[model samples]
Target: MVARDAQDNVSPRSSTTTVTTGAACGNPVCGVRQVTTDTDIPWGLVTLPDGSVLYNRRDAHDIIQLNPTTGVKTNLGTVPNVQSTDGEGGLLGLAISASFSSDRWLYIMHTSPSDNRVVRIRLENGRLNTASEQVLVSGIRRNKYHDGGRLRFGPDGKLYASTGDAQNGAYAQDRSALEGKVLRLNPDGTVPSDNPFGNYVWSYGHRNPQGLTFDSQGRLWEQEFGNSIMDETNLITRGGNYGWPACEGTSGTCGTAGFIAPVRTYPTAEGSCSGITIVRDALYVACARGARMYRAAISGSSLTNVQTYFSGTYGRLRTVEPAPDGGLWLTTTNQGDKDSTPNNSNERVLHVTLGN
Candidate 1:
């Protein structure tokens, strides 16, 4: 770049410097619009092959199907026996079975009377067959807070889930404890023989990891909530240990051998990122306390060129998923955030589109 004066005298050319722009210049989220409103703390979001979306309310315990094309919503019956912790735990993540076309199974993670569990319910016709519910994974401890609940099936067709420490930080460091770990299991909830510990545990030492997604390369990425210092986004590995109670984000005992570090870290207040999804080789994370969306370019096993969008525009962003049409679906958790006194009935689902 060079500068020219009014007299048409051009200055010498400057050194080459590149400037990046949002979405169009390889950043994500070019434009976004409110697609549906009046939601109740919308939690998990998953898109079906039919272009319809299924999401559950964290506090209401009901699943709702949304026709993105029409903005029409259908109340798909609620899961029975779901109990809210009066804090963060309730009906959380949702994942569609790979054989949904034939099996019609929808998986959910929710807080129950005794613990947090993963169950599969049959979606017969247009409503859920509550009687057909089958509890697959159970015995995960729960608490008023820190009940990490996010479910996603990997490319290998194995079910993967994130569990919180149940406010007991020590549990994160114990491989034998189911709490605060990423668990892998067969679709039938059986222990996969190939699992690291010959049990359901896949990766251990996580605090409150709520974000899980597989990149195009089949590498798993997770986002975790920190105690007071840092929130992390990590590239998950099989049998990897993410230091939680022993470390926050590469601080405490993170430098020790065998402990993996996060690809990116944000101050707790600015992050608390919950849900994540990858679209067009870029990773998008919806943050709660920060009330923003973060977009990071995925560079082989790492994240780079990070950018923030809609900071404070939404009360508290909760979930983000790839839309069937190559866009993104985002949900807000404003109804329950005490910081904003958000209108209980004004929570929203947003449609976000990306550019080249």
Candidate 2:
């Protein structure tokens, strides 16, 4: 993509580096290109099938397309009826229909005046072209924090939604509540007949799950935020309960009835993972306070190898999407929070090339 960093240069033969707390990474010649830099909070980065890039600016209420070849941006239009809460509302996640050619339909998870929900819209001619918007689902509790709003269609052609506990501890164990659970439904928002609970609910007991992606094998995986110290990347299974509120990480026993444990976890509190993407043979995870990108090699639904890159070049990196150059795209997020560093301007999109 566009930034000034040296990312376009990653080759299949590029060398790998292992990093830890207070460590440095990337080769002296590894190309990590900073396409552009600004102070706007970027919420998502999505690469269209044709290699074009679309992203959202959480604070600006704007969604724009970036020329993957160049760094230039094309403003699509403001997300209407958005409710950008003090720190964590507005637009969060985005996904395009599998039938993009005929449907040209786009889906977004955002907090509106009412609640956080997934809504669909027609993208005729690639503009917010019309006012045609349909609510796939609604009535999710919205708050200043803990609103899980990531939406992705799984390999089964069902809409998979990640919902946060809305900062309420009780919701995690309340199977009747939609919060703190992963819901699977048809494109129309109704519960699938085969769902374990026979409702939209698929899994429960979570705090605020941010990233969800199914591997090429159709196995579901997720990256979640911890209360403070721990962050997790989990392998999601049917009807599995990921303990939250009751148990933060692997620190304590799940007790009785059983709960699914994370496949891997990062003990470094600052390494708060915001998004996860599975491309080819690796799982790429983006960090917020950690300000770095991590790669985990998976083998048969397990993390086999792990590494980190870009130690601290960017501040609070948030989103990572497939890049046009067979690499990946990342965006910084330090500028969004009022509590961030003074005069923070590290916000921008960075393109990175991963080894084959």
Candidate 3:
């Protein structure tokens, strides 16, 4: 089967017919290989137990199933009422239920006409039943930019979603509002009983958090986009406040006001970290502006042995997901223009193997 470009306008490139490995990072030769080329602005990715890889395109507003080994894609269908407006806001995140085989349910986080929302859809016989869409959570503030869109199921069996400040900095400090916060919810969209605020708000004071994942110790870790100065990787805690407008990185009055400090920070020029994933004991973060993937050794909640791979090789890495084949699958956001690799063959997905 041939691969299709983002617009589905061109045929598959002959050069991508075979998997080619690049350089070595460690003992066994860590390398990156192209899986599928010419994808639209692919945002989120989730792999099922059956090795079915699913991802969503921000502008297309559609969830697609990709055959990892064959590079064949099937459009599962579009999420209803998605607003692919200006910067950042659109169909952003996707997550499959733990009981996917039994329930065949999938969840998507998207920017609707009015606000950002999480909706549930059923996949029957490998096709999305869009007519069966169920709105799980709604009313998240939306803007032309800063619509934080990362969703994941936590170790505790709860849905955790990250929301941006929607260009409104004050929303980070407003507990009554869902903007600029990590929200915890049941699969049915109800607030979890043990949530910090007795509502869906899990952790507050964030400025467009885009990465959410759980470590080996079952602790939540998030990567947030900061202003001009710093970008943060934080160990998220229940009821913890990550000082946002009042603070940029770790410089503001963090300790004094009970705000939790980030575990690590990077200059905006070095990293505009987006998606994060844990493979074995290492945490891999995909950076958009940095055009690289960062690998850090994870020992419980602490991170060390930091290094970078594929820097500028696969322009603007957006999302990274663990492949069922013991490798990592990443998506590039090189959709053209100033923020991405110009004149590239659309955005693509790359597979990388981390050598032991």
Badly placed stretches (over 4 Å) of model 1 are 1-27, 338-345
lDDT winner between candidates 1 and 2: 1
* lDDT tens digits by residue: candidate 3, 163-273: 999999999999989999999999988888888778899999999899998887888999999889899999999998999888888777666667888888988887998
Give a tens-digit lDDT track for model 1, residues 110-186: 99989999999999999999889899999999998899999999999999999999999899888888999999989
**Cα lDDT for residue 102, candidate 3:** 75
- Report how far residue 294 has shifted in candidate 2, in Å: 1.3
Q: Estimate each model's TM-score.
A: 0.90, 0.87, 0.89
Between the candidate structures 1 and 3, which one is better when assessed by TM-score? 1
- State each candidate's clash count: 1, 14, 0
Candidate rank order under lDDT: 1, 3, 2
Considering only N, C-alpha and C atoms within 3 Å, which residue pairs clash in candidate 1? 23-27
Top candidate by lDDT: 1
Error of 3 at 309 (Å): 0.9
**Judged by TM-score relative to the true structure, which candidate is superior, 2 or 3?**
3
